[model samples]
Target: MFPIWIHTKEEVKRLLILGAGGFGHMIQETARLLGYEEVVFLDDAVKGADVIGKCCDYKAFLNEYDTAVAALGDSGMRLYWTEKLMEAGYQVPAIIHPSAVVSPSAVIGNGSFIMQSAIVNTNTVVEHGVLVNSGAVVDHDSRVGCGAHIGLGSVVKANCVIPSRKKVEEGEVIFSTRRKIDGVTSRNLEDALYAFGFGLQCSYVKPFGEGHINETYAVYMPTEEGDEFAYILQRVNNNVFKDPAGVMENIFGVTEYLRNVIREEGGDPDRETLSCIKTKNGCTYFEDNEGQPWRCYNYISNSVCYQLVEDPEQFYQSGNSFGHFLKQLGNYPASSLKETIPDFHNTVKRFENLEKALKRDIKNRAITCRPEIAFALDRKQDCKVLVEQQENGTLPLRVTHNDTKLNNILFDAETGKGLCIIDLDTIMPGLAANDFGDSIRFGAATAEEDERDLDKMHFDISLYELYVKGYLEATKDVLTPEEVESLPWGARLMTFECGIRFLTDYLEGDTYFKTAYPEHNLVRARTQFRLVDEMEQQFAKMQEIVREYA
Candidate 1:
């Protein structure tokens, strides 16, 4: 015998929720707030006044209820039960929490639930059985597919479309298919423009760049004088970089020095080096409400950044560009720059960390990877060569771009000449050889860094020769006789160090780098080791090539 009940909304008076989980209970309260007086649940585990017994009795209770809503969190289960309940002659109304701000033009499908503080903006579509979770925002013209979840605090930027059953993780911002951003808002971005001293009429602000380390945005500021300019905005990844202030100091110092050098050479300073924008407070960086640090740079027009080695000539040009960067910074005070990441390229310290991780064996993941462990452990003594040299004062510490990958250099779009070197995150006191070796390690490979097939992963000697030629051409006069001799060793040691790092991260449960699967880091470690082995076999030839260029 059911108690007499009166509902403010006649359509949802006999509402039945099909699950009694956390989401189910939340939905029950949401139903009450929406004027449903007779809310009931059907769960196998919980006992309540309105439970109406287990889900087994759902078929019998269908005739007693006017409408039903799925409170299950799992997309597949929600979608399955949603179709089944509707097939059984019950209406499935979409439930929107009273606090949610939904657009009048948005199309919300049946059985979807919009949670508190979430926004479904204009012309967006929330498909059936989807959950727009708390504090999530689906911006204008977006599509939340059937059974998909817009996770807590996640932002789906405008014109983006998420597919069915896709899960957008908490606080993750999906900019588009090609990029992901985080912790930025349009209001903050606009404020940053004025803060950075840009007073032009702004046209648009959108997420930009294909960089893995920083969250980037392209800000378009159009002037009334018919001049439109774009600026590159970025949020520094404090996780990878410990000291944002120190990093900015290094960048400002280097760019200021480079500007003076370019002026002497009768070259364009803005195109040759990154020009950092100062905030209204006269600082190089801005701090948002979340403590995330953002900085802006002048966008180099008519420039192209390539990800792959489309041409060997382009790779050589990349080498020359980076070489020029080293040459320009040769006179800068090496002691002035702070080590943004301490022991960053310290192979010996890295080996010690690996050994410590191996001893802890916290994740118990060691049992599955004995071969990779032995591969790293066997080369333990090989790691000390560079460290011992640096300590003995045999190898001079010079300012170097620690990340010497090809894409970090931008090329002139029309001329195809390497125009500038960007991404100065790890510019600190380090070996010139490390920079050269990192470039060879990344660019001279026959296959990708994580290629599964070992047979396809040999080092390309011709590409190595080209890069060495270009790099040596720029710095042959500046590098010391001892620094010249250490070039080959840099290639071998950096590759080995990278392999060891990857294997350690794998053994420690894939903590550092993003892994698509459990064995991804292992695969990467193997590829690096393979390249190291090849470099070892061709060690004498590599030295001859460097000497020839020198």
Candidate 2:
């Protein structure tokens, strides 16, 4: 727990507001309402309301007054002042409005504020220098980290983890308890577009998807015919995707070929696959001023994209969509596309990486997750089966959507059929079994990937059967004999591979995936390992089912 000070009104002689902004005035009003007769501001500039001293004069001011509170809103500067004030032997107590309904069980850090009508629910911890603005609710068991702000009227749902220095905008709703990645502001939207040579006047731009990889936005453009069209604007994460050009080239090639294939089959080409909107210079993607890569795609309006498999039928349709995708690209020369992520499905290489991460133990996180580390090490030989076969000219390479999770396929809202496959950045040359296995690894799970209860997490054989049936029905003729035989191994290897990758990332200080908390990656790794263990017990049955479908 962070060091904090709690004081009664009598103990505080006079309060000092650290800022002179709009929020500083609000803080002054709040102090006045609380019966503080002496309140003054310390600001370098913009001296208007009770401006007594500058930040440089804080040392002299602190010598006279022992009680003060930071009134600034910017989280970084709030933290700077909080440390400085604490070091100066000043009492910085949490300020709570009388109207705010804070639970007795809730914990508030020093210099924090719970504004009027704000509710800090049971067991929620509001950390140092934080702000729970008016009418905002920090739900049960959540942690509002130090210097973070819960904006007015914003709803932070249960168990949500807001990191330090992050801001929740007013009236914004965050559904996922998973910590958010970087966010884009309305001010940066136009400059981001202009960086991509997109000169068209956009009607609106807002955050789009819940994907952890990229910063996505939906851009709206009004047509000359008075009809409006929307496009997906994304700033790809350069950390994960090292080769943006190669990634876009893979997407453009696959989507361009998919468009032609859809047209030949009398389907709506635009609705069937993601259509890339090339830059003004005819490049596959644009380079922003910050040297980050940006790309745009025509949004499939009126279509629905699901993050989870709510219905088994929808999951089955997703299998067909991806399997048919493989069938369509069966003849598209997989070798032509560059490997955006090298050794993406090479289980052997993944384990090697995990071993290196363990050896280095850079973050010292490996000591706590000994069980998970042992589980991965025990199954090291299991990772080699698929790689050995691929090297020996057994399993042939195909253009695989390396990420074949159900959510990647967008379903028609009315028809409930898989209409389009989006997020083509990971499209690469790999075994068909990789695509098949990844679907089962995620979609066939009995519980969520991050479920804490190990008992609730299991391999749902019924869901696996459904996907295999749908997939085989679509690609029975197109897939070769070797690829058909490798389906069961694919499921096992993909699950194991994903488990080790998570463990490796955890050991390496979580540089790759976005984690809500410190143990998030470990929880994910444990779930994947659980599924892998269950698949091992049912290995024969999985192969038998694949043969039955074949």
Question: Best by lDDT, which number?
Answer: 2
For candidate 2, lDDT tens digit of each residue in 469-538? Answer: 9899899999888888899888888988988999999999989988889988899999999999999999
Per-residue lDDT over 126-229 for candidate 1, one digit per residue giving the tens place of the 0 to 100 score: 87888899999999878888889889999998767899889999999997332222323655565566567553335556787766567788877666765344
lDDT value for candidate 2?
Answer: 0.85
- Please give me the total number of clashing residue pairs in predicted model 1: 0
User: In model 1, which runs have C-alpha deviations exceeding 4 angstroms?
Assistant: 1-201, 223-229, 515-518
lDDT of 2 at 281: 66
Structural similarity to truth (TM-score) of each candidate: 0.64, 0.65
TM-score of 1: 0.64
Model 2 pairs in collision: none
lDDT of 1 at 293: 83
Local accuracy by lDDT, each model: 0.84, 0.85
